[model samples]
Target: MKQVILDRIRAALADRPGPVAVPREYRRDLGGTDIVELFAERAADYRATVTRVSTVDIAGAVAGALRDRGARRIVVPAGFPDAWLAGADVEPLRDDPPLSYAALDAADGVVSGCAVAIALTGTIILDAGPAQGRRALTLLPDYHLCVVRTDQIVGSVPEALSRLDPTRPQTWISGPSATSDIELNRVEGVHGPRTLDILIL
Candidate 1:
């Protein structure tokens, strides 16, 4: 009976065409808009707090945000750019140490840089580079501060893919981690940070 039911469901979708494709002509005319605007709009749609600032103010801005949020100690991935956290006084929780569930859960926040950002999808891709640390560093913290440059924001997925080195490990984060069960109700932080602060410079 189970096999019969599964076969029926498969047959129902067999004839449906794949996702709609755009014509080449339409693709050619994909005029661009201001990247900062696109980034903020899409990030908001994904439920992330998006802040725009000049490169010079990055350190002070980051420190203020963390301090205002009452963060006592924060985690910094081993290779994260130094400028982002220069003014932040919180203890720097290095990613070199083994990451246990308890250690991550006890930390106040985490800071890191991204490999790229997809403006169309409001997604940030981490290549597990020095800035990204191990996957566990980002996953365990309650708050995450992600610094992405305007130059790194690509207009489309194809553009983003071209810059990413496929041979390396990567993590694509659209927003705070979330999930839902059979009821269709939504829940956040089931697996990762509950608050995501995106700094676009």
Candidate 2:
């Protein structure tokens, strides 16, 4: 019965005219503005703390950020760069199959690298890439430290989308998890990480 209904719907649509194509006239370039700087500014505007560091000092920066947040039990995804956490004074738990909800909740923080970042919207797209583990690893933790390379920063959303794979599991985060649902009161960490720190290299 389900297949018969679907076949009828498909046959009906097959006889209808196709939809019109919209013109693509939007600007793709960012007028020569520095995307990294724009991304930092937009990210900060979203209440996320952005820290710019040189590639050589990324380890130190990550360490310092984790130290300041007082993170003790850090969750590290599989294939995450070891050098980035070398200076951190904390026990790193590797997420091979991803940790349980209770374990993730108990963790102080999670660290990973994003697939691509959009400057215009100040958004980070995670396709569960190398350092980025399963979605649960990032969603359950209270704090998240994400590393974004300069080259991964794009001028517009279209540019970022072009760099991402549609078939992959993707998480698009504009800022820390938040919701203003109850009584119109704003709240953070309602569903995901409360604190988001981005290390731009």
Candidate 3:
């Protein structure tokens, strides 16, 4: 009986796919090419707007983008970097939970920093860190501006996963929120921000 049980366990294990392997050197060597270009290409493919800008121009670009969206009130996470929105004409709303969904949904936009970006997938992962607030804040808003440092762009999923700590809460956003049903058509802003702008600073 014990032998049969062991054989069953071995069969189950053998049926599963082998663990994926990634080269260690690839992780260290990702910086050789122009990662910003790669990031932009991938983001565009996913239908998100990608902007490359110097630190000096980031604030103005962000403010202008918000204004273009006709957003007068911008929701900011508690730990968002101050410089990104300096002198912006919009009202800055902090990420307090008591901030109603109706009010947040009515706001012009939300701005925050990303934890890490995956180049291959054009994905941004956010841990509920200071600058990144609760998931709802990003989900409920119409427009979202995510600031990503150039150094945070990673070459692949394995490389990005290697850098993340599992203990922390995380949100992975790839393009604007979207879904399609029945006829194979697509719709945006189903569960998260309708417009996603990634500012690589």
lDDT of each: 0.84, 0.91, 0.84
The predictions' CA RMSDs to the true structure, in order, are 5.5, 2.0, 4.3
Per-residue CA lDDT of model 1 for 1-201, tens digit only, reads 999999998899898887787665423112567766887789878899888889899999899889877886888888887778889888987866666778888999998889999887899999988688888888888899999888888777777888999998889999898888848888876768889989888
Q: Residues 51-115, candidate 3, lDDT per residue (tens digit)?
A: 89898998898887787778878889998878888857888898665688887888878888988
Report the lDDT tens digits of candidate 2 across residue range 3-71.
999999889999788888989999876988999999999998888999999989999999999999999
Instruction: Output the better candidate (1/2) by TM-score.
Output: 2
lDDT of 1: 0.84
List residue ranges in candidate 2 displaced over 4 A: 1-16
Error (Å) of candidate 3 at residue 107 is 2.0
Per lDDT, the best of the predicted structures is: 2
Residue runs of model 1 more than 4 Å from their true location after superposition: 1-30, 97-101
